[model samples]
Target: MVPHVLGSGPTAPPMSTPVDRARRGKEARKRLPRSEHARWLPSVDRADPVGVLERQGRDRLPELLPIRYGRMAASPFAFLRGAAAVLAADLATSPHSGLTVQLCGDAHLLNFGLYASPERTLLFDLNDFDETFPGPFEWDVKRLAASVAVAARENSHSENDVRRSALAATTAYRTQMRRLAGMGELAVWYERIDAERLLPFARTARGRRQVESTLARARRRTSLQALGKLTEVVDGRRRIIHDPPLLEPAGAADAASLRKIFSDYRSTLSEERRLLLDRYRFVDAARKVVGVGSVGTRCFIVLLTGRDANDPLFLQIKEARKSVLEEHLPSGPYVHPGRRVVVGQRLMQAAGDIFLGWMTGPQGRAYYWRQLRDMKGSAEVAAMGPRQLRRYAELCGTALARAHARSGDRIAVAAYLGGADTFDRAVTDFALAYADQTATDHAALCAAVAAGVLRAAPDV
Candidate 1:
């Protein structure tokens, strides 16, 4: 049974004058100079990256491990996307700003994207929270900066352009944080980046057109659209289509387990949401593969009908394990892993899915439920040129700062960053260094596959 533990609510920062907050920030700078962040050298005893991945995969579905390795082995950037635990360990070795916030623990570029708000408006913000936990805000910043560096290098940007892209991310983060520090509490809480606001960041006509296309695609990615693509009529009954390892029909036992847990998940939702969910009757389910890091986890997509066969809703039930950052940082509030993810996501996102909820399934595994497709769209980083990459990096940085401002001490963080680009440059340097480490790590993974130390299914 899942433990009945009461989670703590968000606490406001202690009452203090702006002068005191600024002083606190300055003091932190003295303790750990902003320039000190520029350093990054792997320890001689650093754990093998492949071994770390093997440890993470032990608790996952064994058959799916090959697919996880295959997806991560595709590129250095892809490896970084799947190796959040490796990055967490590396970040833990260095001293941090000590500014606590609910981190998007795996805040890579692909994790930030377009999703529909409760009001059906498209908003860009952090969309993944599998690793979300309260930790030094700099951890997420470094991850974002490092992702930009890795992606720029993958696109064959010049060394200077790569560094410039990383710098743009940190620079925008520092500047936006400072701006948020000067805002009223409610104003900072309400701040968001609407999809329309993204147009101004596009420097050229082509860039603008690309942004428009992405937005249009996101708007079309509702549950209704997924019905046509993922479902078919079998003897007048709607059923999920099979697509082999990526998407396949759930077995009789697995389907029964899913149906049994449906009520338990419904209990976690608010009264209104529960009523909304009750309107949809269960139809079918399928085992599915998802993202790079999450591929091996037990994930299932359930089909439900609302008013009629034409009206459908798809909810995804994904396993939630202990966060990668959990061991590196102090203990968090929630005991149930699924609740931790749901709560962390709610705290960090400007708006979240109404169907978000959690439940403990068979054998005490934790799972969270949410819409499978709700106007979600991600960026195509590989296609971006240097100019477009830098702009996108800046946009991501701004969104990161906004998320941090909601959960961390913006005044102190802004003050520590100061009115200069020192911190920005330091993190940028760290990003380049980490990008090199990631390349070496990716090679190690490939070598492991070649030596028969690990199995890697061909990329799907």
Candidate 2:
């Protein structure tokens, strides 16, 4: 279980030494280097598994930006394609972890989405921590800020419009940080951003209706229900159908190995979890696909039946290489990167998927397993207007601050945020500036793809 957060606030200039006192963070937002090189941006830089990713990233920028998610044949999210390969690596090299909580190292715009908490409450936070680790609070905030600029540009919004939206995001982050700083440790931990609680902030009756519609969709993201839809008897044999770009399967050998590892995978879970699933017997399994950056990586789904065909469960095993954040972090080389990542997710998220666990194969690779399609969904970014985006960004910002507070020192972060707009303004400035860089990076990746330097399997 996650321990309660301890808060701290310090306002001092950096010491010239590497002593423990050197660990005390500066109060003012130091003019962070324009690029990620000067002081590391975050700590994920040191992870090696991310390096394997680095080689591929050197040329795949076009496919990872927001512009691409909206235009699949053209590219992936432009910012993601550009940023993850190198910027995340650069951010990771920085020494900011001691400043606040271990952050979701790559907390960009889309990472925040709905998930059912342990109490069945739908809330949001740094949903993807593939690169999560101890790092500066600002790095997460800045990455988020830059993403807004990129997303706005992709929408064909004017520069002024993009700037306004980006700043709104930054300011929200700063304000929310202050709110969290003022809360008691327990109060902070218990906080959540539920849909019903968000009605007041929805700018319009239409927005409220849209939010309600989203909630209705989110409520349907349960494990049993999702598997029931995805897994069915085909030709008197149980199997999952091809869901196009979304739910494709892996190779036959990989599927076989996944089946063999299910029991061993159960050994890694707690007693209660094992007992909760004792009746489940593996029925059919196959390689499945998911996520933007995680595309092309090994992902699989396992079908299990309890009493009969009507009673079913599905488990997904996703290969967990080190996050882009790991490229700069100082963690000892992880023997099982997937296990390390899943354990980190469990530690950070208030509630995790019930099937959330780890598994290893004979080849000594790690995978993070969760119930496939278990009430899993996201807001359609293409559908929201500017005001909704702003409001949603604030929610994401607040939730991110809350997530940080839980894993690290909230008092110190609050103290660092103080009662001003310094942090917010700083993030806004950094975000707009970085967006320019990401756009450039995206162009570079596109060139590489055109030149065949990077493989472009851009499936819409």
Candidate 3:
């Protein structure tokens, strides 16, 4: 089956024939204006956003159920927490005629953090791509702004202060993208952040403390330690522990299909990676759960042990389906969305997990796999302050632009962004405005839950 590319033009493969290809090439060569629908994605009503998210996310829930929340525990605004898809779709409908590339879909302030790179460098990046897909440039920026706005309101910041922080974030993103776009690809790839570099930027004691904690935790998060926690010899049988709401042993047919998928994963590797696979035996594999938004999707963890059973490697295979962003994405040229994600990730991030690979299941269900816990960790967003929120936004925006530049024309975007501060200011305006929308939406969710209109286990 052919997977259609959305906004990605020539960056994707041809449309089968020369005449068809020529027609697409001609349209693509022209500055592709942002579709009218992309722009309004950010302007959705707060009440409507929850409905949209629930709808786009409906297909996955039967696979894994939501851990119910206590009505009083979730901050009123928390309900609107991950409304990035609604915002992204609206943003895609908006305006622009510049370079387009794959986006993180939901580049919120809370999603950036420290993790170990292949070479063991502590790196920062846009970590969550659940909402990832191709769309207008501003969609990510606006979602980021709204996150801060909603978070700040929860934290009791004044409206003006929240707006200012959001603007600062917009400024940082625009400035960083322009700066990085000026560098050579290899140089950008070499760039990374560690605890030492953060000292200069972490202004507050809280920020400093948080960074120190994350770095310390990251250092302790080794493959050896994860092996013990995620796996064990159960009752004389060496098996992955079956934890409800987390690990699943799989039905007979599912396990059979999984074995084939696991076997296929080996061939997807390179000579170097294939050699690495020889170092460990696939001891136990099972379907495991992960992440808030990704809960209902199928996720599996494969455990490996080598030599004296001391050496270990873990791989995570996650089902990749049509992104909710695809609701707004009309098919174009690319047939495989998972391939698009892997390719885009390689382009945008400075470095990626060496084990990254894609596969299609017997049912044509697509998925991508990587190391399960190679120094994998994330920041506790609930602990951040307003200042930290702003700075994080800058990181996400900078990273988003860099990722977008990987497959799209950086020069054209830089030109469209103009040789000035126009783009930054425009983003700031959008952020502040959208932040208001997010707050209003959060309130509606709270009221709905109170009135028993929309069901959530009371926001626990």
Write down the TM-score for model 3.
0.82
Please give the CA lDDT of all the candidate structures.
Answer: 0.92, 0.62, 0.62
Model 1 misplaced regions, further than 4 Å: 1-10
Model 2 off-target regions past 4 Å?
A: 1-54, 57-82, 92-100, 243-252, 332-335
- Per-residue lDDT tens digits of candidate 3, residues 261-284? 776777777889888777777677
RMSD of each: 3.5, 6.7, 5.8
Write model 2 residue lDDT over 269-349, tens digit each, in one string.
Answer: 789989978888877777555665665556678878888777788777877766665445444334577766776676567
What is the number of backbone collisions in each predicted candidate, taken in the order shown? 0, 41, 25
Pick out the ten consecutive residues of candidate 1 with the lowest summed lDDT: 1-10
Which portions of model 3 miss their true places by more than 4 Å? 1-47, 68-81, 204-207, 330-333, 443-460
